[model samples]
Every structure is written in C-alpha cells, then in structure tokens.
Target: MSEGGIPTIDIEDFPAQMGKLREACEKWGCFRLVNHKIPLTLMSWIEMGVECREIIKVYAKAVHGVGMEIAGKLAESLGIISSSGESEEIFRDWACQFRINKYNFTPETVGLSGVQMHTDSGFLTILQDDENNGGLEVMDNSTGEFLSVEPLPGSLVVNLGDMAAVWSNGRVSNVKHRVQCKKGEVRASIASFVLGPKERVEAPTQLVDSEHPRYMRL
Candidate 1:
C-alpha cells in the first residue's frame, strides 16, 4: 500500500480483477482491488467531481417518486421485462444522491465519522479511496465478521448491490460494508453506482436448472 493505503493494480490485469469480481459477487458480495488505473489526477479534479455530482443529482430528481419510469428503462437496457410489478419501487429507491467523502485531521477539523454498515441501492458500485489512509471494512456474511481493507493506490474497489442480488435470484450477494476513521490520518474516497435504465422489468432470471437457478437477471 502507498502512503494513503491506496493499492494500485495494472489495467493489464483486468482479467484477474474480473475473476475477483466474480468471486465477490458469488460469495462475499464485496472485494478490495489493487491497480485498477483510474488516475489520481482525474480522481482529485474538482471540476470533474462537480460534473459527476450534477449528473447524479439530475438522475435522482428525475426518478424521485416515479420508480416505474426508471424500472422500465432498466428492463429495456437489460433486456428484461418492461414492468417491475411490486419491485418497481425498489429500483426507484436505488436511484439516490451521489456521495463523496474526504477526510482530514487537524485541531480544527477532526476526521469524519465513516458511514454505517449498509447495502447500496443499485446493482454495482466502484469506489476509489485515498491511497494513504485506511478506512474501509466489509462484513463476511458467511463468517459473520468484518474485515479491514487498506486502500491501495491506483486501485478501485467494486461491489455488487442489493438490486443485483435480487436480480440474480440470490446467487449474487450484496455485502454489507462500512468505513471507520483512522485515528490520525486523513482520507478521501469517490464512489459511483450503476443504475438500471427506465422502464425495465426487475427480476431474477433462470440461469440453471431447478436445483441451481441463477440468483437474479441483469
């Protein structure tokens, strides 16, 4: 890990990262990665950050109470059913505000309280943390335990969300996670979620036989 606990993984090793992603989806629901190559300069750019924030705000505003509209779109994009039935609203809730947390420690500014343990709304998430300070942790559902994750420079942590688990029919798990403030270190992180298109049906598909069906459909 670098000064900020960030891990850097080479893009050339994307296949290996994909394998880890598949494993996280099937078992842990979350995983730490190194060397995912989303540049630090780009990650720290205020203008780019503002643009991203605006896009999220617009999406949240448009899909506020009309979940069906969002569901329809997601279904269409994923090639699923158009109507979500009872699950339409669930997808709507998935479209929420974007959050960016930057931590700094000082006499005037103490570190921030990390987020509580919870699952996200959308299907997938990509997070980039400050490479030096450590703050992320994930619960191992199977073991009923939590594990600390040190930030790796140039790496991105990818996680599946509750929607994905539901769509996969439980085959994929949406892991629970939280962040804890490091005693004296400063930290920062950027997280982005993938949303469903409007008018798309939300449900799991059958990927296997009755003995082992797929958890959820994309």
Candidate 2:
C-alpha cells in the first residue's frame, strides 16, 4: 500500500496478486491496477480467454471491458464466485454506462470545483485519468479528510461505489471524492461504471453471518 493506504496491484504477481486483490478489497475498498498492458507473448492465451488488444484499440470500449473484468475479479477475490463456476450472471443484462469528461479550468474559475463531491452509485468504477493534468481527490473516511489521487502514467484507479459497500455488508470502503480546478489545461478522464442489477443487490451468503451481519436491504 502507498502512504495513503491505497494499494497498487501488479498483474504479473499471479496467485500473490489474487491475495493482494482480496486484501485491498477487504481493507482499502479500492486499489490502483498497474501492469495492465498485456505482454506481446500472451496473445495465444488471451485469444482463448478475454479478447486481446486488437479489440481494445477503441479506448471507450476498452475501458468498459476492463471495468467489467475488474468487477468480476473482485467478486472472485471475495469468494462471491468460483473459478470453475460460470461467470456471475447478475451483470449480464444489467444497465451499464461509460463517460468521458474534459475539464478546462480557466484563471477566472480557479479554486472552483470541477466536480462536486459525491460517491458513485454503482458497484465499481475504473477510471483512466489524464497523465499531465491533475485535479482529482478521494476522501479518506478514516481521517475524515480528502486526499489527492495522483496516479502514475499508464495506471488506472479503481473505486468501490455505494452498491459495493452494501454488498460487502459495509466491509469495503466507499470513498467520497471530487475534482478541483487546478490548471487552465484541459484534464481528460474516462470512467466506466459496472452497475448492480436493477432488481436487487445484496451481500453474498458467505459475507453475512453472526460476525458480519447483513447491512443492506436488497
């Protein structure tokens, strides 16, 4: 974990990566996923599994794919799904959306907010932030303070949302965050939200027991 408690996951770590994935979800609720760029040699394996780079050239579509994959892996990390079992069908027919935003803060609007403070309403959000411009912040619920999220280039930040909190029986963190006006240059970011099914989103049976009581009504 970094000084601020946000762990960065390195995909090359294999099984250990899975362990870190679980810990980050249970402890920090979010983490930065590094090493997302696929190796050129994994082409054959990827063709048999998740589709590779050719389909990912379309940035928006790629972001959506990555978000869905991360959400699924998070579920597996938490024992909500098993490797041998079929992918959870909850997200199969649910509503999902992707957004791209460009914020240009002029001198006149300096110090003003680019985006009001709020929590996302979905299950998970994967964001590709601008490498050069900085203006994002995430609240540290423990300290009751806002911390700037300055990820390195080629890294993506994952944030758990309201539904994530409820589904984990309030185990995972759902941070409050906002953007501030920092510079005149336009800051661009693309975010894809993997929303919960409209019917009902509830904690898995294993997550709710005498020790971890159910925290939300589905």
Candidate 3:
C-alpha cells in the first residue's frame, strides 16, 4: 500500500483480497486499483463520440444509487455522525452521491487552460477515466503538494472523502485532485461516491476496535 493505502490488484482476485481490503479500509480509508477488468475497449467505445451516451447515463445513475446505498451501510456499520447532530437525517446529503464531469481539451471550459483542481464532497469516490489518457492529479495531505496520478489501463481510482474522515474519527482523509486534458484528446471521467450517514454522530464504532474491527457493514 502507498501512503494513502491505495492497493492495486487484478479484478479476478478482488474477492480473495477482501480481508486485506477490509484492513486497508479500516486503516487508510482509500485505495488505488488496477486490473479491475473494466475493458479498455468498452471505455474507448464510450469516449468515441456520443454513441454510448445513453449507456453511460444509465450506468451513471446506477452508480449513484449504489453509492448512496453503500454510504448508508457504511454509516450504519461505522456509526457515522451527522453534521447537524441529528441521527434521523443520517441518510441525507452527508452520506453519498455521484458527480460526472467531462470537458474537451480547451482553455476556456476548464478555467485553468487545461486542468482544474478540486476535492469531492462525498465519503468515498470511485473514478473511471478515459483509457490510455493521462490527466488525474492528487494532493498529498502530508506533504502539502500535488502529485500527478498516471492513468492505468482497466483500473479504477478510489479516494476517501471528508465525511469519512470525520466519521472514522480522523483516521481517513479526503484527497484533493485535479484533471488535465491530454493534448488533442478530450478527457472523460466518471466519479461515484459512497458517503457516511447523515444525522449520526461522527465517530468510530466502539463495538469494533479502533485499530482492527471485526466487521465493516459497507
């Protein structure tokens, strides 16, 4: 695992690595992934004009739903807390959501000539970028510097969010990132988030040990 607990693995072995993954989640709250088998061809097909717009849209919606559910479960399992101090509102915005933003390689649209930096507003984010294209950059909280993240073919990038850190009692951290368009190639990325529950107190679960938990609901 890297500084942020990012783990890369073959898609086929994901199930076998669940134990390690759970440990990573408990400790670092984020992971980088490789060989997830998302298929470069499919990714390419989606980027080749508007032919796959409908498919992409549907997939995005599904991703959002899944993210929300996952957030709720994470909250329930981790004993998430709400910013407003109301446990009933745990399923509200502080939990989970998805954001999909795409931009052509142009100076005007992205506001920074070709790149834009920002942090997501969810507990965890799952990102899929254009195959063979490079643009993602993440900030290293420890060093207070930005690091260029190379795009890996058929891989997904995952990051923990602010709410997650709060819910986990500062154990996790939300990463800052930016996207730069490659010369002559448009950039496209899909981001799905899993957030903690709203209205719940932001704290780690006592039932589960602070260092190693026996069970993680999400």
Per-residue lDDT of model 2, residues 118-179, tens digit only: 88888888877776777788776667677777846777888888888998788787767789
Query: Mind giving the per-residue lDDT tens digits that candidate 1 earns over 1-218?
Result: 11222223233454344444345556777655444333455544422445576554653343232224323333433335433344464454454434566766443433454677898877767676666776687777666676777766655676667877767566667878887776565566666666554444345453345875654444
Pick by TM-score: 1 or 2, better one: 2
User: Roughly what TM-score does model 3 have, to 2 decimal places?
Assistant: 0.61
Tell me which residue pairs clash in candidate 3: 6-32, 81-200, 81-201, 81-202, 82-199, 82-200, 86-199, 87-199, 90-198, 95-195
- Each candidate's lDDT (Cα)? 0.55, 0.71, 0.56
> Could you tell me the lDDT of residue 4 within candidate 2?
65
lDDT of 3 by residue, 103-172 (tens): 6665444434355666565577877766665667677655666566677666677776666655566545
CA RMSD of all predictions: 8.5, 6.2, 7.5
Off by over 4 Å in 3: 1-6, 9-29, 35-45, 48-54, 61-96, 107-116, 198-201, 207-218
TM-score ranking from best candidate downward: 2, 3, 1
In angstroms, how far off is 33's CA in candidate 2? 1.2
Which has the greatest lDDT? 2
Candidate 3 achieves a global lDDT of: 0.56
Candidate 1: what lDDT? Answer: 0.55
Of candidates 3 and 1, the better by TM-score = 3
